[model samples]
Target: MSERKYQPTWDSIVTHPTPKWFRDAKFGIYTHWGPYSVPAWGENTTWYSYAMYREADENNNPAYHHHLREYGHPSEHGYTEFLPEFTGEKFDADEWAEIFAGSGAKFAGPCAIHHDGYALWDSKVNHRNSMNFGPGRNFVAEQEKAFRAKGLKFATTFHHAFNWFWFPVWNKEMDCGKPENQGPGKFYPKFHEEHAMPDKEYHEWWLGQTKEIIDQYAPDLIWFDFGVFSLMEKYRKEFMSYYYSKEAEWNKEVIVTFKEIAVGQMLGNKSTQFTFAPGTGIMDYEKGKLNNLTDNMWITDTTIDSRSGWGYVRESGYKSPERLIHNLVDRVSKNGSLLLNVGPRPDGSIPEEAQYCLNEMGKWLE
Candidate 1:
């Protein structure tokens, strides 16, 4: 077996006390909004983006044909091409925040960017952004304004690194894994070639984008989904410095929720170690939810329905309101937070099922 990767030992922020605001306020809101949502409802994710590069002609799921017919192939219409459809006109940030407050959310956050590489805020790094193209509005700033107005903490989740790699199939110009080698999508003229990976240019682009969002929104918390430790040390340091500097300016403390087994020394302990960081917490990915309470505080993020994908899907079935409330009570009793998700449609409207769930949750909170 190959050697294990190095895990950085970077320490958690100890300059200030773990903010009382976040500790008291449990639960938040997160949305997986992007070009994927533009299609409004599909099977969980933009799998076609990666399946186009797979070796086997057959995909793990046979949904590609449906996706192609639904949203033309990459050649004719690249994922980014759908940016025009992501209009948040229907998105009422203040109203959403108010609903969160009513639902007993301590803070509110948006998927600043998802696995689709589209930043919710205006980004100078990549042209594909909510401010400039998708929503054509400063969604992050709007979210911050609305949530802060309600005295709720502000947070942002970054899933850009995953997207940077996830979408390369589009750039690779590979066929739909067909040995016969079909033609490229309309926008992607090249077919059956190596896809371009993010190089130094992409790295610089990511940094610039990250910096822009941080400076513009000044989120009280920045949650990185996966690539935190894999990031270059210099970039990691810079990110930490920027985050700390920003928090200092606001006269507040900021928290970064990270997991162990990442490239760097995990600020938090592994599930085995139970060495969770202070103010920092744990998140039970899809299958795992904390059952037994730990002396440490943690958060469990689960979907309303295990069957439905995280992003909004039209035919999706959601969990009952009772189950959701049960989940919240269970987690809180264990000293954990519940971060619920509402997969908004491409037009920036919450789906009926998600809203229904939230409304039910609101009733329970009241």
Candidate 2:
């Protein structure tokens, strides 16, 4: 492998340096879509699986009440039920590529696997994936080919690190995460208390999935979600080195992004800290922005639908194109890039509102 340049050490890994392509390409687009899109419910639709199983919180989560009214009950109609509904019948990979390219995005891709344990790729590691169940589509592979054909650098986002705590499997009464319900050996899912630290096997599967994504897709960028902060230092080091090693073979610079400074129970783990030391990779702000410009490369992932969730619902409160343009300009002015997110419907159609916004942005950019 052309002499692996990075060892699994922060000191060694930090030297791998941010790529100029990322710095110059000031805008990108990625998606938060999957079976969760089927329900098209919840304020934070991406977390519907988790919220559907819980009692109404202090804020009165709409997904919980919505589940009761629409889907019957989490005990009977769980997240798994949505898999069949996520047929993606209208999912046109080439059409999606055209829409993203029209948005003036430089890089684009899928969320791949969000906090939902369900994967969109044909996964050998997780049996409960898109190919075996759900829409029966290899979303990552489809998008990679189409996006690259459209002259867009492909990126994939992984939020599955928190899949360990995503579902309350310990409840016992719910069929959602029950051992038998998950099918044959329970499919490498974590069965732990919300606050518990996952065991060694779960951590191994986490790394295995990351490697699978790396080897299979060879994406230009990999943006990790906040769940990564909960990972142990060794897994973090290993994945970074493993991804960086691809630089020589791919003949293109690759980027791995980490969130800035997450400490304490932000990941719902109490009495311990899991902080990501920044400056090791590209810094990312999730639904946040910086007040001042900086020399180091940074990115902000904000949703295109201004109201509601990252995953699509029936109705979207799309940001006006002018607002999106200004936000992009502001981030670019501050030496950071904007990774705008779009939540396509379960049928794989980009919302007309989102399409108009992107079209307007594209025209303005032109």
Candidate 3:
């Protein structure tokens, strides 16, 4: 193999091309399965746990009332308690991989860690992970093996970067601020009122988690949620540099997907906000689509049932299979990949409605 010419710097990394395999594949599958799936109750979004904790009105707030009635208050029975119910007893990694392969997806994986701070794999940095608390299994490793066995490229999504701010760290009513709360601080670190931004220690922990995922799984693709732009600049660059360097070491063309956050959204600092220059990697649009054909390749990550929620809901409405198929065709025509998402139940079973849609897409492909 020829020597890698690109360094870890943004200018050098920009020279690296998007892998041909990704551009040609045009479709992939990823799941949003996590501890949040246990409650399986949220509005249309995946921020149910946060909402349940923040909302005080049990009368109007369904998630809040549900949590209070079912799992007790957020102060006493925090989100960490959901870990026990997250036992993936019925989870079949091979079966999920087979479904993805049968659906004509070229790549498939799980969101290794969500903003909920629950790591799917056996994480060394955080004890509040699937292996230790919930499933007692390395879910990511199982999925990776299954994906590769079916000739599919493995990928992993990381939303942990946003966990620092996603939860109500300052809310004294929640377990986050209570020093007596045992696991809440580990999962939901107490925020310093003086410093609105994450401290150096938190940034290092974030980077370490990313590195741990990369070193352990060697995912072909790493997808980031929107809040990553708010992360520290040095940490962002360090992660990208380390990831790209690892790709070179393994002699593989790895891809990193990031969403562009608009100005004045989260941090209001454009200079500090992370934005990928053209050709750095892939650009992802969450629950969004483009109007015109883009010269640069991109991706659209929409859920099978956009109305219910991305995780799981007691009663959810789903988009029709025909609509999803049409969206897939339109995206492919515009040089974009469709990374369709499906939320599995807490028991680790893919909803029948999601399965129906995937099967329909497979038939359309055939």
Leading candidate by lDDT: 2
TM-score per candidate: 0.79, 0.94, 0.92
Please identify model 3 stretches exceeding 4 Å from their true place. Answer: 1-5, 56-62, 182-186, 267-273, 306-308
Model 2 lDDT, residue 256, Cα: 87
Q: What is the lDDT of residue 212 in candidate 1?
A: 80
lDDT of 3 at 172: 74
Error in Å for residue 61 of model 3: 5.2
lDDT of each: 0.62, 0.83, 0.80
The residue-by-residue lDDT of candidate 3 on 132-172, one tens digit each, is 77779999999999999999999998888777776676677
Estimate, for each residue in 46-108, the C-alpha lDDT of model 2 and write its tens digit: 988888888775367767887888878788887777777788899999999999999889999
**Which structure is stronger by lDDT: 1 or 2?**
2
Best by TM-score: 2
Candidates 2 and 3, the one with greater lDDT: 2
- For every candidate, C-alpha RMSD to the true structure in Å: 6.9, 2.3, 2.8
Q: By TM-score, how accurate is candidate 2?
A: 0.94
